[model samples]
Target: MSYDRVRAVDEDVADALTGERERQNDTLAMIASENHVSEAVLEAQGSELTNKYAEGYPGERYYGGCEYADDVEELAIERAKELWGAEHVNVQPHSGSSANMGVYFSVLEPGDKILSLDLTHGGHLSHGHSVNFAGKLYDVTHYEVDPETGRLDYEALARQAEEVEPDMIVSGFSAYPRTVDWEAIQEAADAVGAYHMADIAHITGLVAAGEHPSPVGVADFVTGSTHKTIRAGRGGIIMCDEEHADAVDTAVFPGAQGGPLMHNVAGKAVGFGEALDPEFKEYAAQVVTNAEVLGETLEEHGFSLVSGGTDTHLVLADLRESHPDVTGGEAEEALEEVGIVLNGNTVPGETRSAFNPSGIRAGTPALTTRGFEEAEMREVGDLIARVIDNLGDEEVYAEVAADVQELCDDHPLYE
Candidate 1:
């Protein structure tokens, strides 16, 4: 029997899956941290490797019948290393956060001083957000982007590093939409004799395709999520200098997690292979183009953009001055009514709570991957602006929803 036919035997399960798929087909995913993987990646993820219990590295396995597993794991590591120009790559960490934890655990003592970017300024929670393991376990110093320029305050970071003399300095973010200067960050890290770690989770594909700066050779450690811009399956990878390979490997396995997920690793291998294609480079370039168009269009529409605009695939819009009456939460709901999906984010010095912030973070990666271009992005921006302008009007929302469906149908994703 076919898998779908067998699944159809359970009526409620089939209904649930069908309904969820319909939800995906209807909504536009503008979340920067999300993307739709190729069906090839999905197929590899559901392959027979799902039943494996490979606990050790390639060529030295803990289980029998490990030849193919060895080959797949080795290929993932080699491809990842070459893609990023890293001396060593450990593709075992389960998530970006997990990869982050591995780095901290591998290098620092429990209370060692660590410096990282602040969360409100586009840093991740795992980068010492006070609630995560990094903040709780390490002595953390945070730096923010300049309020006036809405960019990294590298001078302030340098001062903090010199003052604190931290053991490590982490440079990466979850909402930053500008380019990162590894040289400046490396200087700060060097000033303090710190190990520099750059998490390119949001821009791994961009870096792989030369759309963004590479931190592989510059930083002591680099980490990323495969599923985001990399278009890989859901997992994380950590790359480092060859000298730290064993430490990183131990950190990922015994220090942070147990057995690796072989199925996901297989999917990652497939993703890495796809990322090597020349077309992926074009895709990466288009991501930036679409973001530029959307940002320029929104600014022209009188919306206030954080950093004045974007240099990357994301655009963070300030809703306070643009649409003061509508909070980020309300705007999110309004856009959702129009089949546009995005996340509310905290603006710099935001007065509102996190649940209903003063900003919205949207991106073009998924749309660009679906073959949308600058023209479509302009239309998308217009639709988004209109939705924000008419957030409280149910009639406008219903009408916009129809238009969104038409637009999506005209340029169907994953077709």
Candidate 2:
């Protein structure tokens, strides 16, 4: 983790690198999609495999000197298969979005219809936001969570599926706090004769540890980011039945991306190995427990959680109900000022702009990775409430900043 080598060659880059390391050590990273990979995973990601260009799958490469690349990729693929229990797994797509793209390419032609959750209601851009390529290439419709319950209505979704009759139905979410019923979604897709693609990008680790219901067997295709809840390095994965294995692999390679980042695949392999250990189940369980504690604490302070609470590692709070004057963007800035970093998120039935939305999303994957438990998470929730309650109070910021520093010291990272 030292920047000595970089400093010898490039002082500017080295300074930034060192500063980023220091910042991570100092702040509480509460971003829903972020987590700290172990040093082993980090080292694997920073390995010399970065120079490799093994453009194809194992035992079927397009170039020479791919012996090591093949080994790394095979190990990653095998580990991912074991982790998610898929008949076939592709550890290639450069990102989760790309993984979605690969799946889309494998089956649907351009202009084929897609049905997914609304982005403001917890969907990802790749699900078909107007600005994304998926939106441009596909005719996309949406299903919304029940406004009253703030949860999916399976019957309503089924009705919508029949009405839209989309070529595909995407399950999984970005900011949702509840566990998904993949079978329900699958049944909807079946009635409509549509493919069910469950994007478990945010809940990969939870699913792997059996803390959440997995979509591997229920959905036609499953995609996820390796880094989010899993603590794998930055990468995406695709899983499908053996029947679609060829199509998925080809789509991932020549269809969506070329020359996989083998270093990242190595990181995935290392992290997956770590996840297979018995302790990872405990870590995954703690992540959910901490999130519940955090959500409960926030609720105690008068904040209204989007779905009322969490069954996963993240919770989304709608500021409109409690602090009507404070926008999510404003709360995000004030929280960051005190070294607590999360994101301004858009809630269901959003009444504000996406940039400065009505909600804030907080998560516990990074905190749990840093050894934080329920008590520490509760304290964090209190600090967040204090900051949000007194946004412009400089004295309060100083007090919270001191407390954050103390918490950081108590649970040191990369030490």
Candidate 3:
């Protein structure tokens, strides 16, 4: 609950909302997949449009009085198409996972094969972890980066594609720090006649701003979250060539999700508008720059980083090397004590369980949105390293909390 932002809610509602906002304002948010959306996005998301339920696609509808909802949703769809240079766009998957699932539905049958990156090595669950629907319904073939260098082995990936002849080859990751070679993946997929999907949720903003390579033209299907880098509402979108438009749209509408959230669609419009601005390009560039500096700072402070360093906004730290006794979860909790928030993650070949893995994933998107720059990120990196180093020491975290407060004070959000 963010008290400072919501005035219309009752006392209790305001109290809850304001509390969350206050925490967000105070904390250093380094979670790789998180970001603070603009105020306009928030306003659109919580607008009166939520009161209506307009099931079906933009122009075609199942219910009466969907005129305005149709306009809003259509605007969102057009904006998405313009933003990503996609021939077709479906902005109603509810989440990136859902969007991935819809893409699967569009391209493959239930028992078809899929080749995706290994989950523990950086791929998302939707790519085909055992517990996910992708793994449950499909014959999933896993690929891994070179264990020695912690980087993608395109040659090995091509070899696997040739052997498996998978129905689809997913090229993306949730925790990877290096830039993906979309063209390489396209070649790999083409060699085996496999469909290609790029889950660019984390890098959508970077791609839009030309800070990262765009998968829009290269991938057969591109899926992403509106919130992470795009700084939009909390939802997912699917982009593809004109060839797959009908199948993808059907998969999202009657095939998977019910009616779209008109309110969130409105929010998506606001975010897309913001992303189209020139300043968003500058912001996206700074996001990657801040992350690289922070990653270096963490390495200099004795933390072992995944893939040596980050070329993107995320940095995955292997805490096992620097603090063998402290698990990722422990380090996460310790950092929270000092108002620094980040998620524990699994590193490649991690011996520990996923719930308490050996790595912590951090990023600069949220802090950059909060107006922190490269210098602040370096200081944040140092503070994060200190917190992880002294996990069980209460006095140490307390002292670090003071330092965190000072930093936050210097770069206060929403003042």
Which should have the higher lDDT, number 2 or number 3? 2
The deviation in Å at residue 187 for candidate 3 is: 0.7
Regions of model 3 farther than 4 Å from truth:
1-13
lDDT of 3 by residue, 1-415 (tens): 2454456547777877778878888888889899998778888998899998888887689998989998888888888887888899998888999999899999799999999998889999999989999999999999998998999999999999999999999988899999999999999999999999999988988888888899898989999998888898898999999999999999988888898888988999889988888899899999999999999999999999999999899999898878999999988888988999998999999899899999999988999998888788888988888777776788988888998888878777766
Task: Give the lDDT of residue 153 in candidate 2.
Answer: 93
Rank by TM-score, highest first.
2, 1, 3
Q: What is the lDDT of candidate 3?
A: 0.89
In model 3, the Cα lDDT at residue 164 comes to: 96
Question: TM-score of predicted model 1?
Answer: 0.97
RMSD of candidate 2 to true structure, Å: 0.5
Ranking by lDDT: 2, 3, 1
lDDT of each: 0.88, 0.95, 0.89
The true-versus-predicted C-alpha distance at residue 226 of model 3, in Å, is 0.6
lDDT of 1 at 158: 95
After TM-score superposition, the amount by which residue 282's alpha carbon in candidate 2 deviates from its true location, in angstroms, is: 0.3
- In terms of lDDT, the poorest run of 10 residues in model 2 is 72-81
* Least well predicted 10-residue stretch by lDDT in candidate 3: 1-10
